[model samples]
Target chain A: MTSRDVLFAAVGLITAAAAVLAVTNRRVLHAGLWLVVSLGGLAGCYLVLGAELVALVQLLVYVGAVVVLVLFALMLTRSGGGEVDTSPAHRWLAAGVGAGMTVLLGGALVAAYGWDTREVAGPGNEHIGEEIFGTWVWPFELLSLLLLAALVTAVAVATTGHSRDRAA
Target chain B: MDLPLAVEIILKAVVVLAAFLTLPLAIGQTEHKVMAHMQGRLGPMEAGPHGIAQLVADGIKFVQKEDVTPASADRWVFKLAPAVALIPYLVALAAIPWSAAWVAADVPASLLLVLAVTSVGVFGTLMAGWGSGNKYSLVGGMRAGAQLVSYELPMVLAAASVAMAAGSLSLTGIAQAWSWWWLIWQLPGALVFLVAAVAELQRVPFDSPLADSEVVFGPYTEYTGLRFAFFLLAEYAGIVVMSLLFTVLFLGGWSGPWSDTLGPLWTLLKAALVAILILWLRIAWPRVREDQLQRLAWLVLLPLALVQLALTGVGVVVWG
Candidate 1:
């Protein structure tokens, strides 16, 4: 294997390990922290696989925003010795879902690429912009519209709640 | 130019590490003396010739002091938080273009890299807050998280305008495209970026996280010695990176008289000027309340940044 393949494998391994740790960690906050490591390692894997823009965006959106937001919520919750649910049924269901996803994704990848080594170009911002705005414009705009809807709903809910408080 | 890849990487890393170590201390010293003079007071004048070595003295002290972890704190996370906070700025500094050829790593989309890495640095504060097991730290962390998430919108929008106007996502490319006209053209966006950056750094007028009277040093309440110093160093390094990034984004980095020969010097001078301006801002402004800071981001900076973005889109279309 080439050095790039080795590096990618190493990063992918770390990402998988971190993902497992994230799910299995007993402490909720520690689980979120492990999620950060998993996401970061996934970004590293993306970088090694020659997807620079995707890797950076993963770092930005997932590791930076998502995990931090989750951490923020967990921090503010003021948990007084709250235990994370570790029931056997929940664990079994999570395992089944995880296994099913793994099989589905692995099957899809095998069906599409089938271990065939095909060289792909490293993604630059310009290329990604063109692809998104050109070929995937509808999808991109649709996603933003959804985001806008959520934002408006959030503001409306917050404001109405404040007004109710004032009225009372 | 033809050196082996490993050797070149090592050299570049060493240079980046050297700058990463010194420049923040340099900026810290400047802030001390500059803030002192700005307030008509002598600030640490005895360290070495107008307190030039005050940072050095502080460094010695920090190195000698004990690294304390509270009994109730999460050991690993607490210990690791400072490094988490400091390293991202170092990585961002690496992506920053000192001059045309003076950068450590001119990644394909360096602006994104810088933005991504700096955003991740927020985890440092969050982890410290959580790991400390202090109520004040938790509150401070929540405030910081809210402020960061809110300000990030305007900051990214402002940056997106520059990227659009320059037609490149690379920091160096932006610098190369920068001209005197952009000083006027990008003024609104620049203001948004400056405000957002100051908020991001948690300095005066936006330092609710470290509101000592309210939170007793906030997330840093329990940290002592080297870890605390690391947090302070991280803040100073943040100033250095943010100022340099600002220079690259708006101030026509390395573009000055005789810049062909003195390009790196010009970049440094411009960045230093911006850093000093940031220091002046801390002195000139009073601390803002948390809600006010949020309102400023949403009501003022966000709308301003959106207008700047639309204007930039029109300008890019017309000018291109």
Candidate 2:
């Protein structure tokens, strides 16, 4: 096998393992930390595949901001230290569902792609920019609007409570 | 004559790593003497000639001290936190163009890589805070995470403005495409970026996260000896990286006279000046209250960043 293939396999394996660990960690804070590792390993996979832009964006948004925010909220709520208590029945159910989903997805992928290695399309900033602005512009802008609405609603919610407290 | 790819890569890594290790000490020395002079006192006269080896002494002292871990702390995370805090700045440094051709790694989107890795550095502080199992550390980490989240917006926007102007995301490309007039045009965004950078670095005036007065050194309260030194090193390294980045983004990087031969020197000189300015800021302003800090970032810097972005778009459309 080629070096690139081996590298990709290694990164993919690490990402998968980290993903599993993230889900299985008993402490919520440690789970969050594992999620960071999982996301970071996924970025490494993207980098191995030469999708530098996507990889960096993933690291930036997911591992950097999202996980940090998750950890922050956990710490703020003082829940970072405690181990999550899960019933044995619920744990078994979660494992079964997770395993089933994995099998289903793996079977579907194997059926579709078979053994062929598809050629990667352009992977850099230029092409990604075109794809987003050119083809996906509408959905992208719509998403922005949705986010803007969410942002405004959040501000209103946050401020209105503070103002009520001040008046009280 | 071309060198082997592996050798070239190794050499570049060595140089970057050297800078990563040494630049922080230099900056730390600058902070010592400059802050001392600024405060009308001798900073480190006893270490070596003019106290130049003060950081060296500090380094030795730190190395010799007992590395203590709090009994209640998470062992693995506590041990790992300092490295996490320190590595991102080193990675970011590899992407910054010391001159048009001097960057260690010319990643296509180096700016994005730099910003991404630096953002990841916040996890280090958060880890230290939580892992320390100290109330002060947790509170400090919370403030740091919140402040970083708040300031990250304007910082990214301001950097995005630079990228939009240059029409390239590469740090080298940005430097090459830079012209004199951008200094005037990008001033507001530059200010926002500078402010955001200070907050990100947990420096003076924007240092509520590490406010020793209230939080007892914040996430670092539980840290001792070498671990504390590592965190301190990370902060100094952060200052150098951010200052160098600011020089590249806003100033005409290596663009003045004799640029061809003196390009890297010009970049380093400008970056040093910026570092001095950052140090000077320590004495210039008091620590901003956390509320005021958030208000400045969200209400002032964010709007200014948005407006600057719009202006940049207009400028590009009009001038292109």
Candidate 3:
């Protein structure tokens, strides 16, 4: 394998391992930090694949903002110190569903693309921008609207009882 | 005569790391003397002639002092946090445009790279506080993270406006685009950027995270010896980085009447002026309350930044 391929493989393995660790970690704070490691590894994979802008965005949004948000919520709520138990029934159900989905998806991917040797298109900043604004404009706009609605709902929920006290 | 690219990069990285290691001495001493003069005190007068060797003496002391950790502190995280805090500044130093042809890396997205790497330092500060196992340190880390999040919005928005104006994301490109000093044209954006930059550095009036009066040096309280020294050095290095960024983004970087012949001198002069200005603010202002800091960032600076971005976008379309 080429050096680039080796690098990608290494990063992908790191991402998968971190993800698994994040799910199984006992302490909530440790789990959150493992998720950061997983996200950071995914960003490294993107960088190795020559998607610099996407890699940067992943680092900025996921590693910087999302991880901090998770940690902040954990700390602020005083829930960072607890150890969560995994019951046998829940573990068995999760394992069954996960294995089934992985098998189905892996089989479908091999059937569809195993015969092809064509190179995949690497998406750069300009290409991604054009695709989003041209072909996927409606979906992009709808997603933004959904996020806005979520934000407004959060604000409303937070202030529901505060106005009465303020008025008094 | 050509060196391999890997070798070239390693050499450059070593040079940048050496510079990062030594910069705090000169800069820290200058800050001490400047603040001392302002407050009518002699700072570090006994270390050497006019305290010239004060930082060197301080460095020796840091190395010789016994390393100590609290009984409750997490050993590994406590050890790793200072390196995390300091490495980003060292890495970002590689991409800085000291002058034309002087930067170690002139990547197309150097500006974004610098911002992204430097933002990770917040994680370091957070880890330091959390690993200390002190309630005060944890609260300090939380405040640091919140402050970083609040200020980063306006800082990025202000930078985006500059990128729009210059049509490039590289610091060297930004410097080359400004035939006239950019400060005059983008004064509003520059002002917003400077304010947000101070908040980003957690300087006075925006230093609730490290407020000695409230939290006892915040994250550094549980630290001792070389570890505390690293945190202090990181803060000084941050001041230097921000000063260089302000010079590059707003003051027309490296471009003076004689820059063609003088080269990096112009850039150094402008950056020094910015650094002194930041020190002036530290001496002049008192610390603001945490609530006021958050309110000013969200309620005031964010809106101003958005307006500046819109104006710059319009100017680029109409005037360019």
Candidate 4:
């Protein structure tokens, strides 16, 4: 196999491992940490696909912002560092559901699509920029508004009547 | 014989490795000296001719120091966090156009690529916090996440204004389009971008995550030795990256008065000047409260950036 193939395999393995860690880890904080690994591996996959922009966004938004916030919320609420309780019933049910969904999705994907190894050269950044600014301006503006609204909501949620709790 | 792609790749890799290896040491020394002067103290004067070897000494110290993991920490995640943090900064270096033909990888969407890579660095911080299993670290990581996400909107909007004006997302293309740089025409966008970029990098006045007095070193509180050093290096690298982006997107990359004679050197000079300015700001300013930071980003900067976007849209339609 070519070096590229080996690299892809490594990335895929790491991603799978991270996903498992995220789900199985008893500590909520540990789960969040595992999420970073999974997302980072996904980003590497994007890089290998030459979707540099998408990969970078994956790093910046998912890894940098979303997961950090999740960890922050967890820390603020939790008293100390220890493995969070995960009862056997919940674990078994989650494992079963996860396995079933994975199989179902895998089967559907394999049935619907050909396993072509051909590479596709997608549109460049300039083209995307043109399309975004020229044709997709309204949606772009809406996304900004949505983000603004989310920011406001976050502030409201974070700063509400739990001032004493937060301070503590 | 036609050289194998592997050989070419190795050669390029070496050059990049050398540059990365050297640049940080130089930049760190510069920062120490500058910070010293700012504080009215002689910094690193004893190391090697005005503290030239100061960074090298620091690097050695970090390496020699014991790398520790708290017994309560998740061992694997703790080990991985530094690499996660360092890689984003390194990958970001690929998209930055240092000079004409100087970019490591001139991806079609260089600007987007940079934003994306830098964003990933946040995950590293998050991982460090979470994996450390420290309350302070987790709180710091969360604050960083919220702060970055909130500010990212204004940052993207500000960048979009330039992309709209330049009509391209390629850093090189943007630089080339600067018959008159976008910074002058879109001063408001430039202002917003600079502010947002600083916040995005989690620098002072906006570094609620590392508010040492408050958060007790925030996400990095649990880290020590080389791992902690990596985080510090990543922060400096981030500052360099943001300064370079500002130079490229708005300040006209390497375009300057001495462009004809100085060439790429002129660009380097300009970039260094911008980096120094950022460092100066870091020294001069105090940290803003977390709530105030969010409020400023959403209520003030975001709206201002939107207005800038509107103005650009008008300008584009009218001028085109």
CAPRI quality of model 3: medium
Task: Write down the DockQ of candidate 2.
Answer: 0.92
**What lDDT tens digits, residue by residue, belong to model 1 across residues B1-320?**
49999999999999999999999999999899899989999899888887789999998998999888988888898899999999999999999998898888988799999999999999999888888978898788889988998998899999999999998989999999999999999999999999999999998979999999999888888998899999999999999999998999999899999988899999899999999999999999989998899999999999999999999999999988
- What fraction of the reference structure's interface contacts does model 3 contain? 0.28
Residues B1-320 of candidate 2: C-alpha lDDT, one tens digit per residue: 68999999999999999999999999999998999998999889998899999889999999999999999998899989999999999999999988877889988999999999999999999999999999999999999999999999999999999999999999889889899999988999999999999999999999988998999999999988999999999999999999999999999678889999999999999999999999999999999999999999989999999999999999999997
Task: Residues A32-137, candidate 3: write the lDDT tens digits.
Answer: 8789889989989988888877887788788877788778777677677688998999999998998899999999998988965545445876677689989999
Stretches > 4 Å off in candidate 4: A1-10, A46-57, A79-168, B1-4, B257-261
RMSD of each: 1.4, 1.5, 2.1, 4.1
Query: In candidate 4, what are the lDDT values of residues B5-74, reduced to their tens digit?
Result: 8897677667766766676666777888899999999988777887789888888888998888998886
In candidate 4, position A3 carries an lDDT of: 76
Best by DockQ: 2
For residue B215, model 2's alpha carbon misses the true position, in angstroms, by: 0.6
lDDT of 4 at B94: 65
lDDT of 3 at B232: 87
lDDT of model 1 at residue A132? Answer: 99
Using Cα atoms with residue i matched to residue i, what is each candidate's TM-score against the true structure?
A: 0.97, 0.97, 0.94, 0.84
Give candidate 3's TM-score. Answer: 0.94
TM-score for predicted model 2 compared with the true structure:
0.97
Q: Judging by lDDT, tell me the better candidate of 3 and 4.
A: 3
What docking class should model 1 receive? high
Sort the candidates on lDDT, descending order.
2, 1, 3, 4
Candidate 2 chain B weakest ten by summed lDDT: B98-107
Residue pairs clashing in model 1 are: none
